[model samples]
Structure formats: C-alpha cells, structure tokens
Target: MPAPQFDPAAPLQFVVNAAAGSNAAASKREIIESVLQAQGRRGELAFCTPADLARVARVSAQKALSTRTAVVAVGGDGTLNTVAQAAHAAGCAMGVVPQGTFNYFARTHGIPADPAQAVRLLLHSVPAPVQVAGINDRLFLVNASLGLYPDLLEDREAYKARFGRSRWVAFVAACTTLLRAQRQWRLRIETGGTVRDVHTLTLFVGNNRLQLQQLGAEPEDTIAGTPGDGSMAALVLRPIGTLSMIGLMLHGAMGRLGEAAGVERFEFDHLVVRPTLPQGRRGVKVAFDGEVTTMRAPLDFRVLAKPLYLLGPQRSTATAEAVSRAEDAGA
Candidate 1:
C-alpha cells in the first residue's frame, strides 16, 4: 500500500456513522478511544447520525480549507461518499473506515473494516487523489446506476436483512417486475465517437466492471471492478418478452445470459440518453451511488476525473496491465 501522504502529526477528525449498513449504524466509541489511546494521536471523534453526515462533512471541509486536518469516514460507501465530497470541497484528503454493507470501495482498496486497523491506516497511510463522478450537482465516489437496480436499492437493506443474501430475492423481484412492468424506453447511446440506439430492459453506467464469473452449467455473473479509473461502462440489456425472460433465467441457472446478443457494453466519459418515441417518454430512475432519483428522458452521464484523495493499495502489476488494456480498448 502507498504511504499516507499527510503529516502524521496533523490533527485528525474522525466522523463516525451510526446507521450505515443495518437498521442503525454501529457506534465506534470504544474502537475510537482504543485506537486513539493506542496511537497516542491527538484527535477529536464525532458521532454522526444520518442527518448529521452532510453537515459534518461540510463543516469538516470548511475547517480543512485552512487547517491541516484529515477527515475520516467511519461508515459504508454512502457515508464515505459524503465525506469524500466534503473533504474534496474543503481541499483536504479523506480516509475511510468501512462499516457498512457492500463495502465495495473499501474491499477493492484494502481499507480494513476493523476500526483499529482503519485508524492505523488513516494515520499512517498516504492519501492520493482518486477519481469521482458527478451526477448533475451531486458527487459520487463509486459508479452510479440507472434503471431497475436503483429501484431495488430502495428495498435492498430490508430484503438483505431478512434474507442475509441479495441474489435470490433480487432475481425474484426483478422477474416479477419484468413480468408486470412494461419495458418501452428507447436510449440513444453515444460512445467512443459512435452512436447506437437500443431498446433495453435496464441500463447500467458503472465506473468499473464487476466480474462474478464461475465455471458451471449454471449462470456466471460478474461485478464491475474498476471504479477509480477515469472511465465508465455502459451495460445495456435488451428488452425481452416473457418467454425470453424465462429463458434468460434458465441461462442464468446455466451461469450465462442465454441470449447474449443484446447485452452491449459501451465505455465513455460522457453519455447522453434520449428517449425515442411517445411511450419512451416515461422517465427513467437514476441513482447516484444507489440513491434513487427521477430523471427525465435523455439523461446525461459523465465522469469527473480524480475528484478526491483515496488511500488504497495499488493492484498488482499484471492487474494494472490488464486494466490499461481495458482502458485502451474503452478509449
């Protein structure tokens, strides 16, 4: 891992999120005190409710504008996003202490979920400028989602809390929605200086590609993995009929999308999605990092390069080479 770029002697502000992954977020008082005592670093710890995150982040950023203080987010991706935005706005570096569901960024970056280790990293690790995205006026550290996935996130915690896993319930919900929901939007995607029109079930614009590949007669799915790179992927799923949807599920059981013709992948720095006809006039749901919001037809998605400082380990050289290849292709 790269060394922390900040001075070790600087004052640190630890922001703890108490409602991150579950019904309520966990408290970090014990861990915070322990880490502070262990490190002997003079720092102030602040517990933030969900309502206080934005305010605290903004305030921290403003203070950081003049003072050499580092702000740490002690929560999940959303919380980290808030902190990143504020820290970036304040022109200060931020660190993560992941304590939430689907700690995608943390997992990828090697930030430990353990509070003590996270604190150690925050104090010792170097902070580097990382990439972030902006949806309209809002900023996001990870990729954004548009379509069914965003809607699913509304109930993601509820369903996952009840089931302990997401796939089965998500698949069922998606199937049920597909059966009843009408898929009638036309999207004109412009990528790599080429324009293509497609009618699709859902559109995913992600900062990285996640791979969930397994060898079997069953379906193999992957998650996008590259969120920090200065690019995004567009996964367009073609609209299918009821029978086709059933076949798709069967293929998923076999570990692949049975009909793969319409699954087109596009990479671009900017995207403009325009509705085609009258039925397509119905707006789509767009989420900036899983928070759902309504967007009119012709949604525009763009990438903001190196929006904030992230402290994480570099992927292996081979992985870096492969990523370079992928970026070259996408470019």
Candidate 2:
C-alpha cells in the first residue's frame, strides 16, 4: 500500500478515548492541544468515552476514507486496536497517539508519547503496512494470550476500578490468581502438516511476530521476522510444575529466558487448537487486545499482513528490516 498523505492545511481529526490512562481527561486534552501547537497545525478533536470508542472509530474511519481526513487513535493499545481496525476495514490511513500506561506497540514502532512529536512524525512519515492477528472473526493488534493472563482481562474493569492503572497493582492481582490457577489444558496444535499434543500453561499469538518483553518467544523462531511478513507466530508454553513456572516467570521478568528447549514456537498462516480432556471442554479464556472472551474448544488464528498504515520515525524502517532479516535467519 502507498504511504498515507497529510495536508497541514487540512484539519486532523482525533477520536480520543477519555476513559483510558487512569481516567484523566483533562491531561489528555492539554497534551493534544500542546501537540497541535508544537506541530503548528490546527485540528478538530472528538472526545469519546470507553462506551463510544467502537462506534466512534467506525464513524471516524468512514469519514476519513470518504473525505480523506486524517484520523488518529489517542489512547492505549485497546483504543488503538479499535480505531486501526476500523481504518483497515474502511481502506483508510491512521495514526496513533499513545496515552495509556503501557504503550508497548507505540514504543516498539517508535511512535512518540508527546502528541506534537507523534503528529510531526505522522505528518512527515511514510505509512508502513503492519500486520494484525485474528482469531476467527475477532482481530487483535497486539498478541493475544489465553489462560491466566487472559483471565485478568476478564476482570479488567473491576481490577481497574480497584487498582487504577498501575501495572504493579495489576501484576499483583494476576499473580495472586495464578497461584491458584490450574494449568490442566490438553491442546492439539497443527502447523505445517504436523500435529502435536501438548499440555501448556498459556497460548500467545502475536501478529507482529515479535517476542514480547515478558512473554516468551515463539519456539519456532517466528518473532525475529518482519512485522508485515504476512505470517503469524505462536508460542505454546507447556505447563511446568508450579515452582518451575515461577522460576521461568522470574527469568522472563529479569530478561533472561528466550528460545528455551521446553517452549514450542511456530509460524503459520492458520492453525487449529482443540482440547483433549473433558474438563477443558468449556474452552479456554481468550484475550484479544486486552478484551477477554470465552472461546469454544477449537480456535483458529491467522495474520492480516500490511493491514494498517502505521506512522513512525524514519528509523522504524531500518529497525523493522533488521528484525525481519533476523527472523528469516532464525536469530
């Protein structure tokens, strides 16, 4: 796809997610205005509450494609996911303005936190196509993890209400749950004509094909590749003893574990996962961009290559290229 065009003379429309970032609306508005001033551009802002993000995103994306207006997602990953997906479906271009606690996607792609810097990048940067992950019909911008982590998203609203947006607080809550969580999953994974029977603790599917910070890498060396490679990666983590699981968690926390033998990782265009045990019949808890849903026993996932027009600094291209090469070489 071609790069997204920006006309400084034209107004940039922002669909802001007000409920994000600790429910601090005033600070977000100030940041937006300051960024516009810094970019020397004047634009219109549309504030959206959490309840409105999905509908507003569709409207904004349609308007952007129809009128060729610049639409930006100004919130955390979830907000970005909603807007970007709409833009992709509508065949329009989009940019992201990170304002949430963990803007991991933005940071990985070199999107600035300061609205002005991000706007400047968006105005001048080339639009690079980025891939997305989808399970059945649901799409995910970042990786989706099933099991204990997803269960956290199942209670996100309550957790956010009680703990606010602090990652530490969320982590504590998750750990508390994990202590009693059972990993009695019997999974059948099919990829590249091979079907493997595995009992795992978690299943994480990443569209960008990159190993996340805390999450382990795909056992098949899939994450080292290009983001828009038109392929998806999977990391199937078998359930170790709880004590060993804790040790692995610490290793991942301290940044020590990557591509260990115990973990199985693979890359594919499509796959199916089914449970072998009756207790697993209710299906697993699946998470899509922080939203949780209970899925049937069998799950299907695929990669949508070059689905979004991402704006970033000039260095992103080089970094992405390097990563792609590394993935190809199984680095």
Candidate 3:
C-alpha cells in the first residue's frame, strides 16, 4: 500500500470518547498531554460524552478538514465509526487509539493497544489509503451483518449492560439470542450477475481480512495477501435446527466457522440483498462494525473506489513484525 501524505508541522486533533474505558481514567488527559509535550508537538483534545458524541465528532472533523489537521479517534470501533463518518465527509486523514472492547479495526491496521504507544506511533505514522465498505451510504471499516447477527448484537448489548462486557459474556449472549430467536429470513441476493434465493439466519459482509480469518470465513494464507482490493467477503449462514445451530456456534467459537456446514462464503465488489416476502420491505436491521441500525429494503452493499486515508504504520517488514508482536500480546 502507498503511504498517505503527512506534514510533521501540522497540528493533531484528538477526539476522545469519554465513555471509553481509557478516557474514563482521570490520568488519560494528562498522559496524552505529557506525551505530546515531551515530543514537542501541539495537539488539541476534544472530549466527547456519550450524549453528544455525534455532534462533537462532526465539529472536530469539520475543523480537521478546514485546517488540514489529523483527527484521531480515542476509543473503540463505535467511536472510530462516528469520527470516520466525519473524516470521510470532510476528506481528512483519520487516526485511532484502540480503547474499546474489541479493537478489530485498530488491530487490523497494526495499531498498538497500549494508549501511550498508540499515540506515539500516530506521531510517527503517515496516512495510508484503506478500503472502506458501506451499507446504504453508512461507512464501516470492518464488517456489516444482517438478520440474527444484528439481534445477537442487540442481545449482547443488553447482556453487556447487565453482566459486563467480556468474551464469555458475549458468548453467553450469543447462545441466548440463538436459542431465543431462531427465526430465519428468506433473502434474494444478487451479486456478480448471479441471483439466488436463500433462507439464512444471518449474513455477514466483511471488509477486514483479519476479522475474516478470525471468523474462519477466509483462509489464513489469503488474509494479508488481499488488501485494498476493493472487494469484500460475505458469509451467509443458512437456517438450521437448534442443535445444529449450537454446533455451528461451537465451531465459530473454535475458529472453524468456515468448516461448519450450511455456511457459504463469497467475495464480491458489490451485492444487493432483498427480502422475498413483502413484510420484509419495511426495514432490515444491520450491524455495521459494532453499531446497530435499521436499513431500508434492497440493501445495497459496495466498496468505495476512493479509499479513506488513515494514520497508521506503512506496510513494511518492520510494520509486519510490530503487528505480529501486537497480535501475540493481544492473544
């Protein structure tokens, strides 16, 4: 991948999600200030509360776009998504500090999980063009899904609020959702001139190769080989019995989802999915990245030809080594 242009003299604008765990810490602001002061760099930090994140992100993005400043998101995927929407709108380079439950986007881009390290890396990194996927104009850096997956996200959120956010909690929530809502939707999918009807419990469209590998939807060998290809991997889970669904869940938990029966995977530049029944025309629930939203019928999914410039390590041997180390640390 080609490196995005960067100016060392430009100011950095950090949009911190105060709701994020790292930002909730009282010393986070001091840490950021101290780091930049030590580096002799100037930065403006904007704290975004849960109630006004959208507004704060938009204003920050507008400032970045106007001033040609780098806007860094200091939170998880949801925070990144909000800032990304603004950055994309303003046509400015975006950066991220992984401070969320699952920092898939940051991990995929080789960003360190440690907040101080992440900020230091951002200071030295340049903009890199990365592929961005969309479900009806909403941009997502990782993946988007429909049907039972969205329901699972909803259930997971509720469970998270009650039991706390953890891998085990998420797993339990997934089980609860699967057992409680076994309803399947019949969708008519069209991609690359092929039109087919399918009854699926969930459909996932993945843009991040690392996430695809984790889900076992793509072969490990092909994960790093395909980047900025302007294509996405789609995994469709067909309707199955309760026992079989449980088995599928086990396979997914084991990182063998691709080996599970009734799971279909495809790579496409564009796809159109619609419900076979008139009742489905109302709207379809979609989970983009980790945020849930309702999208109208005939959901159009595609990759933007123009990439989003993100502040991250330039793809190189050293970067690869760093990413490997980060992955090992995360594991």
TM-scores for all candidates: the values are 0.76, 0.82, 0.90
Model 2, position 301, has a per-residue lDDT of: 79
Off-target runs (Cα >4 Å) in candidate 1 are 1-5, 19-26, 161-181, 210-227, 246-261, 276-284, 295-298, 314-331
- Model 2 alpha-carbon miss at residue 161, Å: 3.3
Taken over the whole model, the C-alpha lDDT of each candidate is 0.63, 0.68, 0.80
Candidate 2 off by > 4 Å = 1-8, 19-23, 155-160, 209-230, 259-262, 276-284, 315-331
User: On lDDT, who's better, 1 or 3?
Assistant: 3
Best by lDDT: 3
Per-residue lDDT tens digits for candidate 2, residues 1-331, read: 6655645456666788885444467777777777677777766677878788989988887877666556789888788888887888877777888876655567567676666677667766555666677776677787777766686665555777886887676656666655666765667887777888888777877765344533545335453454335666676766666686666666555444554434666677777877664653566678877777777767887675546766566655646744554344344
State model 3's lDDT.
0.80
Go through the candidates in order and give the clash count of each: 28, 6, 1
Q: C-alpha displacement of 195 in model 1, angstroms?
A: 3.3
Question: Ranking under TM-score, best-scoring first?
Answer: 3, 2, 1
Write candidate 3's Cα lDDT for 1-331 as tens digits: 3333457667788898884445374567887888898888888888867678889888887777777667899887888988898887777888888887767778777788889988898889878788898788898888899988989988999999999978789989988988776678899999888899999888988887766766666733323235324578888888888788788888888767899988988778789998754643677788997889888878999887767888888767334744575466447
* Model 1 root mean square deviation, Cα atoms: 6.6
Residue pairs with colliding backbones in model 2 are 209-223, 218-265, 219-265, 220-265, 224-327, 226-324
Model 1 lDDT per residue over 1-331, tens place: 2322466577677777774454433347667667777888767666678788899888876665455667888877678878888887667777788876545566545666676787777766666656677765667765676655576576665566777755577566655555654655566877556688878767766654322121011122323333346566666668767776676566554445524545555556777777564654556677766467776756777777546766554445324544454344335
